[model samples]
Target: MNNRKEKTFSEVWGEFITSQTAKGVADITIRNYHQVLHNISKYLDIEMTLDNLSKSKFDEMIVEMRKVGIAHNSIATYVRVVRTFLHWCKAENIIFIELPNIIERETVKETYTDEELELLLRRPEADCSFCEYRNWVIVNFLLNSGCRAATVRNIQNRDVSLADSQVIFRHTKNGKIQVIPLCSRMVNVLRGYMAVRGGVAEDYLFCDQYGGMLSHNALRLAIGRYNKSRGVAKTGIHLFRHTFARKYLVDCGGNAFTLQKLLGHSTLTMTKRYCAIFDADIAKNYDNVSPLAQLYHPKEKIKKQSRAS
Candidate 1:
């Protein structure tokens, strides 16, 4: 029997890529996997075969990445991609080596405060220009709906129903359709934008000057310019999504499962992290509302003499 363990890492990776493509994975995701694998191959500095891919080798790679000042999140991504490839190899009967499964990820708190969100919402001055109006509508819509940048970009005029107070997100990150209800404020904003947008042949609700679909870069640049003007740091387009999630949890009493569906997450893990962050905020005020703390002291005094008798 030909030993499958003799297969080179590159050969296994090529097969994995073919499998991923056949599975209909997104092009960008495939590219990311390929890039990470290539980086791993370079870092190992050896002709890595399936048999040589030990847990220690993976650990060494991670240590080297960290030593080079790679960010924790980036290193975590690398570890995840590598582990996935290794598991694929095992499933394909390419290697039987036990692989380490755990990859520590940094707890990144990347969300806007209420004040920052307020500032962002009111950033655009009252101008009648298409650019000004479109930016305002996009910002508000993102905050209200918690839809991703890609989902926002793909929204069509027909997808929104002002009468129903809902908008359907057809092209989501996870390939699952999400229907988000429109708040009254968001509904009013959309109506105003549509009026200024007028009846156009373009299908997309938000479009460029030439009536073309709005690109991700355009949205990024718009947000970037706004951030620059206001001197806001760590404010990206995705911050709006984070703000929406946090606000939904606090203001609307939303739970992890509901947030998972709203955010179109494939799993509840990411949504749970949002819950944790929200819980932390709640913890900060726990002292004032602690049941025991409030019950221990009473505002009204009973008649002590009657109790003694």
Candidate 2:
């Protein structure tokens, strides 16, 4: 055959990985993919060239991955990314092996228990005057809005639209500006904090003593220390978010699609994980529509059918 542009599988895969790494995917994601490919490459006993890889090799690699305690979720992510690259290779007529067949991943639930949430929200503030007040406001806002830590850290005074009773998330994980309704408590806190904050200070709502934007790490550490001092466990900003989601879904009887939209998740499937973790009573509450209670003298279904016949 004439010379073709069919490239080696290994070569294309390497290039694809490099390109994806440059696109701002998380460091953990990059490392996991690299490690998975490296292990697969080693198991084939040879170069494990993409053109030479077979179904048997893929199966052995998966078994080894399981033996090493890699989570199914992680493996599923790897399969997705790898398959995307391999499909591209196939389009170019360069595939020697098909992508590994993996089961659909079960979602991992990460919601906080009520006790953990109460501990996080009630973590005592430091004796610092202004800092303590600001942190209280921060905790309250996080509990009410379910905003991510990054979004909470980046809140500017202008982001709060008091007239509309809304707060805009400027830099969400998906880069969407999500506008959440400001709870009355949040509005009151914001008003009080702003009354103390001078109008001339042109920066974030919560700033360091130096009048700069708040450091995400410092905020995290402060919250952690506060929790430690109170002898409460599991103190993280994410826990606040988890608490907010669970409480709102359970206590307020909110729907999944609405929660998904409010939280700015890209998919309903992502929000379903939170729903799945909720107590059975919470899920049942949403389904409790009693026709029997509404109808005092309802006709029996079998009797009604017999009478009609």
Candidate 3:
């Protein structure tokens, strides 16, 4: 009698997702994994098995995704998800195939310039109402603190200490508690907003007109509307982050290590990329700092006189 264990592709995927959930993966991450898997299934439309999963088939799926005009970064994300899943399966002895290590990705980092930020910060009308005040403060907080939208959404009154000139991030992307020092401008804005907020310590710092906590989407949409009205292009919450990273590096002459800490990055790889993006600025600064540029140059007449003598 033949005795062998076999599982369908869907079964293996379910098990993998279950394992990820058990490991305390973020809900958004798990959802993204499920979405990528679903897309793969829809494209392949084949009965997947441990023995039948092949690199050729995966490559074909990638080609199909490209033909449909999927963004390069998105395709890379799909490839990464699939590669991780296949590695997990291999560890579980469900499949044995060489996983693709590299996926073509385009680095399309976007950031707001100082002029753009000035325009955006002034976009909100000069109204002292709760909503207007909150919106202005939100834009300032995002630009000054460089915190993620999720972090901003999760901020509570207790997390902020105006006297200390800092805010505590209870839930960060890396799952680490971080305390970011607030700039004087940001502190002033927070104090003004708090005077109007009038909420308990446990209540969220930012709220809607109805005094309810704001969602991430609410913050995004608010910014989007303001951007559209102001005629700003490529507007989003993450642009604040990119702008912060770039400004931190350029303004403060910060290195990757310090940037990694401030940005709460697990490694310097991404931070280094930010440095690369600002290479032109770095070069211009280098030109000013070079000894040749700093030293006084002799005139051509002096050189000619000295040679004649």
Candidate 4:
């Protein structure tokens, strides 16, 4: 064990970031990794040699984080990122120890209500400024497509096709091109927005006041102000995504398989969360779908089952 080359955690982390950058990982992802590193750094000494790494040490770090009031979900996120980093270290012959999973209690993700959606979707006045019009169109787009704000920000004018009834999403979370069909309402909304947005195909679909790409902070603040103006207290941009998923599964009677494709999830893991969220929908349709219920019709029972067991 002493023969193995010794490297500080920070040194290995620097190498990991460089490697991830070379692999074409998204800027947002790299930033997220940095955030996780910052979080763990507060608990563990990054300058220490990785020779001290062990499951027990990490378990203590997790407890330390919790004692300081870090959220369960946030800690889980930190652990996940750390696990990936440690896995890379293992491959590099730095350390080899199995990590334990954190129990992440699933909380139903909050989404916009019907009332909130109605207020948000209300057509802006004719005299509204370009940003006003654009923000309105973006809300419509987010609800219809359930895309990440980053995806929306990166959408170019050429990605939309009124004739084709679809929009090409080039900059998605999974870094895959997604072709999502546009609803008639969203299509019409985009048509008017594009007319006002007027730029070449290369121009970003959603731009700032100066007709350049909207930064992450710009998009977030814009949506926040837009929601507040519409009297929506829930201003999270991603809530629109949760809202879309819920409405699709429950109101539209959509299936999980198709939702997976539409949401661009590489696996059913994330998509299944939406399914689990709307488990009531499954119960409501249980009789219609259950094979046993379909095969056997209870002859009108002469009398109901007794109250006694």
* Candidate 4 per-residue lDDT over residues 1-309, each given as its tens digit: 633337777778888888889989888889898888887988888887777767887888888999999999889888888888878777877678788667676778888989999999999999998888899999999988998888999999999999988999999877889999999998888888889889999999899989999999899999999999999998899898888888898888887778899999988887876445657567766887899998895666587677986
Instruction: Tell me how candidate 4 scores on lDDT.
Output: 0.86
lDDT rank, highest first? 4, 3, 1, 2
lDDT of 1 by residue, 125-161 (tens): 6654677668778889988888878788888888889
Provide the TM-score for each candidate, comma-separated. 0.79, 0.66, 0.82, 0.87
Top-scoring candidate (TM-score): 4
The lDDT, on a scale of 0 to 1, for candidate 3 is 0.76
Question: What does candidate 3's lDDT look like per residue over 1-309, in tens digits?
Answer: 111125566777888999999998866688888888777786774466555667888888888988999887677777888888888877877676675765555364678988788777873555556766676788788877777887888899999999999999987877899888899988988887798898899898888888787876687887787677666786688888888877777776766687787778778886666435566456756755787866764445534345564
Candidate with more favorable, higher lDDT: 1 or 3:
3
**Mind giving the per-residue lDDT tens digits that candidate 2 earns over 36-127?**
67655654443445545666766776677788887887666666766776676566566545776576554534666666556555634455
Error of 1 at 141 (Å): 1.4
Question: Cα RMSD (Å) per model?
Answer: 4.6, 7.5, 4.8, 6.6
Worst 10 contiguous positions by lDDT, candidate 1: 100-109
Candidate with the larger TM-score of 3 and 4: 4
Each model's C-alpha lDDT?
A: 0.75, 0.68, 0.76, 0.86
Question: Could you tell me which residue pairs clash in candidate 3?
Answer: none
lDDT of 1: 0.75
Residue 133, model 1: lDDT of 66
